[model samples]
Target: MPTAVQALCANFPDLTPPATLALRLEALMPSRRLPAGRVLFAQGQSPSAFYLVEDGEIEARFAALDGRMSVLEHVRAPRLFGLAAFISGKPSRYEAAAVSDSRVRVIGAPAYRVLMDDWPGFARALMREFAERFEGNLRLLEAARHLSAAERFGVALRQLADERAGPSDAEGWQALRATQAELAQLAHLSRQTVNQLLRAAQAEGRLRLRYGGLDIRR
Candidate 1:
């Protein structure tokens, strides 16, 4: 293994003494970046790789027959996306897009299976990531089921707040890159409804938008 690859894999229990991180990565995964609003992959496309976010955000979205995209999941920094169809041998059921300029790790199927064969814990870790994403999606779905549009928006903020510890006093720079229209889809409401909710939240000091990004305060 190259020195850097060894260093990178030192903390990873599944890592092998491969040629290099870059070489093993060619087998394991490669990094990817996509522009804002561009689809990384579409529903029913070949599932080639599993993705883990290194930076920025990705929304796992689906477009209706009416041509509107609904967000099923929001993947933030240091999280994973693009694993569903990758593991299941199905075409992607949704589209993934950068909510902003983003970076992600793309693990090819061949290399991933190799890792799975050698590292039980690594395999379990991937499965665990999928479970977490699934449950998080369910929580949003449930919130939309019971909450009013405005309240659903509140719920989204609360969820994000919980993720970033908005309820705690650990405030810092954060970005909610979702546009109101996008938030509408996630909240299962109209853009106007989302705007109204956002306005309300802003008035109450729970959210504040800077020039390019929105910040949520608990």
Candidate 2:
């Protein structure tokens, strides 16, 4: 099995640094295990560290005034979370929790700053990550503004498949580990609408529903 440093390098290929620098980074970041449903950080909490998910899933959620929580993002392994708040020196905008039992590498604010100041490659990689996420958010907003319910559902399904689906089978079908309700939330549609869309897609040979998920044709 690869060490944490190796996994980090694999996830962020642009973060190339000298051997000594990589060693220093490994020393600065520590790994932690979180049980499923455990909250990593809550909304409005001060940012102390950013997390690199090494295994399992994390959910970024927003709580409404009515005491309801909505998932804003699903961050799978090999992704970084909490960096925006940490870098901006602001309180967290959403709560982060482990969707499943998870392992993560914690990079404290001081260590992040030291690397950003000393390692040009690391800084560039982080900037690129931020830019990519920003562009994605803009596209999502555009979709929501102009796309129909079915079109929005299609886009959401495709995005989720691309991000977190299992390997494609010989028939070009990939397993997506998400329920109809979760898909509805991601598509910003009602559950009934999502169900109708799923049935339509299935009838068209685009996807098939499973017990807890769906197999989508790529």
TM-score of each model, paired residue for residue: 0.72, 0.87
Model 2 C-alpha lDDT versus the unseen true structure: 0.81
For model 1, residues 38-62, the per-residue Cα lDDT tens digits are 7888888967887666667888888
lDDT of each: 0.67, 0.81
In model 1, the Cα lDDT at residue 117 comes to 70
Q: What's the lDDT for residue 110 in model 1? A: 67
lDDT of 2 by residue, 23-112 (tens): 677778888999999999999997789988999999888887998886667888788889888878899989999989998889896668
Worst 10 residues of 2 by lDDT: 1-10
Stretches of candidate 1 off by over 4 Å are 1-23, 162-178, 205-210, 213-218
